[model samples]
Target chain A: MSKTVEIRWHGRGGQGAKTAALLLADVAFKTGKYVQGFPEYGPERMGAPITAYNRISDQPLTVHSNIYEPDYVVVVDETLLESIDVTNGLKADGAIIINSQRPKEELLPLLNGYQGGVYVLDAREISIRALGKNFPNSPMLAATVAVSGVMGREDFLGEMRQSFQHKFAKKPEVIDGNMMALELAFNQVGC
Target chain B: MAIRERLSGNEAVAYAIKQINPDVMPAFPITPSTEIPQYVANYIANGEIDTEFIHVESEHSAMSATLGASAAGARALTATSSCGMALMWEELYVAASDRLPIVLALVNRALTGPININADHSDSMGARDSGWIQIYAESNQEVYDNFLQAFPIAEHKDVMLPVMICQDGFITSHGVENILLVEDDKVKEFVGEYEPEHYLLHPTEKMAVGPYAVSNYYMETKRAQRQAMLNAKQVILDMAAKFEQMTGRKYGFFEEYRMEDAEYAIVIIGSAAGTCKAAIEEIRATTGKKVGLLKIRVFRPFPEEEIAQALSHVKAVAIMDRSEMFAGSCGPLGAEVRAALFQAKSQAEVVNYFYGLGGRDITVQDFMQVYDNLENIANTHVVTGMYDYIGLRER
Candidate 1:
């Protein structure tokens, strides 16, 4: 068996599904795991459903297709639950990280009897407060690493720092602020 | 040593992009071509390849951001399909006419409205008139190889036209097959390091890529662009030959199969040629009849002279087109083939079959059916695909 943890993310075109997946893989690599992050595309117009995936492993991985049954599913937009089936073909032992204003009880039925581990957070509010934007990719990914117990909270922060520093290297403050957002989300939802 | 892997054209495209190590990649995923960008992003994140993968909002922006990166003198690339290609249509033309060497991989799909997500050439046909140099591939290997050749072709000083390497959506892009890749060193040598002369964002160099050519010289500038595109023909042949010598794999503008001593032939492009080859062989064995398959690997800078020479002796030829040029009487490829052979001495009966629109699977048997129809129609009139008659739409 491979030492990778495969993640599948569901969201609309503009909701940063692909970004969140890439950030998770970047963080995983910084923690010394081989990773793969990508997205599935169709007529990916704005507001259309889309999926992005990540594979994190200690060793190299051979799986290169779409994540059919992923180890973790990150739902960036809770509204995707209505038209799109976010939880379909999820691994039995997988965990789902969702962005919702409501608690787990309110969102469980929307998952259609998905019995895997569930961690819910209002990443939208977190993004607005921490970064002054509606982009919840960084916070949601941080919450995922925290809930899934994939890596320590400290290592997750370190990875976020490295990734943010490089991505927005032009804007150090932006990187610093996103790192703060990751810490806040990590503190709000502990593994 | 390079690893042998079973990958789809989309995956091969992703693999090539990874090797190129682009500075920026932004692709709005469309079916057939979606997997290319996805794989590149994953590869970048995993540290398999170091690159910046931008998750752009739309295909138009995907192309726009790639232009931005390319203009900044960074190796930038992107992919799209069907409507996504249409969305990028205006920008794609600008990226080319402005002589920005942006490499784009287009997974060919039918454009929307009837909204078919299947394999076809409609997307590419829409951009055929765009100033971009277009190269078509028939397999996963071709996808990998053509992309390896595209960078140099696009960035060539005399031919600074943007290049679009196209493969059929699901037929070639989605189907998985084993392929032998050229060694990485060979790929690097074949494409060479990208050194931009007039990048937009470079501060030290005072140069411009996209400048307004007014009416007085717009036509002259357009003439220069055309001359540059024509100049690429020899460069492509030279590079493809060099690639063959290095990799022990032969590529050509046209790949002729069983074209010897044939009185009749089938001419088409894309993955459909694979089916035609199989059907021709089966028909020959059973009936001892001689028919050939002419696969058009290069669409633009249409290989008219070679095609005419190849079919000069054949009595009849059938052109299989996956997309229809609605306003015109003939399908796009069919019209081009007929025009190419119009001046040939042999009066070959050329018939056009416009089936398999929008990813409809065209099997070997379908080719045999068309071949059979070609023989009967050679002496009579043209036979076309069944159209929705006045009463057919009600069903």
Candidate 2:
């Protein structure tokens, strides 16, 4: 109740990391709170190391910028951690949410001093099982909501469903599949 | 109550931007101009202004995003220095030729190699041929005021060309001063919401921008851009007059400081104009040498008529340029001034004095040297390189 959560997302260009951040902001906003979403651009070519950000506050958010120090990080792809210092600016209470096939012990070096929380879910597995492809952005977002406690799980899921229904309104199958992936990853994170 | 505040030129630009209330800004920071974007971003973050600050990857993207936003019928802005501007040179030409009505506050910086981050007009002079209307500001006040005037001048239907307000880096961009600013609503009322006749990316309307200007119509498109530049002369004056009416402040193609009844005159541009103005006053008071100063504000549309008119009575004209165009026969602005004055029938013996190259400090004492040299000049057809340091080769 005393925590103000700031989330950072790590992914490559063309991987929908920015969309994930914006979606988190949208959901957080619907909860009658303040939020901002943005991305940092550097040589914005495909497969380049990219980061997007989100901040949710019960009060109005004034600062709008790329998140340098984040409270919780949602890792869309485990491999990005090798090239990225995911815990570079994480607070002591900060947490890591990774879509990894490896165990948490293997990720300890990457998460080093981050002792607040860790939510390990094979987002690739849930994404493959639900969407039949390795689109891990939604699963990572679900894992983020679980580990961060920025919004209630049910409200977050409802907002995610509403977003998909609007964005993929022309395709009902895609919307349903994305919602299922959200739920599967949410459950896998054990929130 | 008049509020006296001392602020850097970057602060002045930011102050003017707040007054202009441009809806969209896209920029990347480069030295000297870096503080400007930083300040603008700060304003956006603090809820002090409502605008879209597009954090772009490079100056090219910054200009491209500005063009996109401006074409979307939103007032757009951006700033850059040397290589940043160079990177956007191609897009900059397109933005101008297409008449996008974007205003850029350029902090003039030297081009890299020997990698100096100091002040110079070399970067801006390099882009002089890019078809955008360029205005050189002499002080922090002028930097703030010129940009406030730039919007209406650029967005005018008659002149939709992008406008650049160049202030010398560190000298003007970082130097602090106090100047008056008009009320916010005053500027808003003067410029008004941009109702563009031709815009891009409107869903309900149809318009073509930067279409293929192939062999057949390339010449015509270029002609249209040139005509737009030509049309800007009257538009600038009209806007200045309106600015005067609303704010009691007026600016023109050039500000003449004691140019009347002088045998010798020094015509300079940018912040150096202030130093020259002081030198003119000092020289007139002590030496009574009848020295005058003509500060060129409007660089593009060349102000040929006004320049010729200002120098018509003067016996000699020394054009001081802070940039060296190695490819050119003379300093960039010097060449342009010569071309402008050449039209005069007086044969007023114009000399190109390449001074202050690479941001070498040019003080009133330096202008005094040029003044003394101009008085002693027995030869009319010659160029003088002044204040040359030992390592620097004088051309």
Q: What is the lDDT of every predicted structure here?
A: 0.78, 0.78
Clashing pairs in 2: none
Writing each residue's lDDT as its tens digit, candidate 2 over B250-357 gives 789998888778878888888778767767777889988988888889998789878888899876777877887774457777777777777666567666676665
Q: For all candidates, state DockQ relative to the true structure.
A: 0.02, 0.01
Top DockQ model: 1
Please give, for every candidate in the order listed, the TM-score of chain B alone compared with the true chain B.
0.92, 0.94
Each candidate: RMSD to true structure? 11.8, 16.7
TM-score of chain A of 2: 0.92
| Top TM-score model | 1
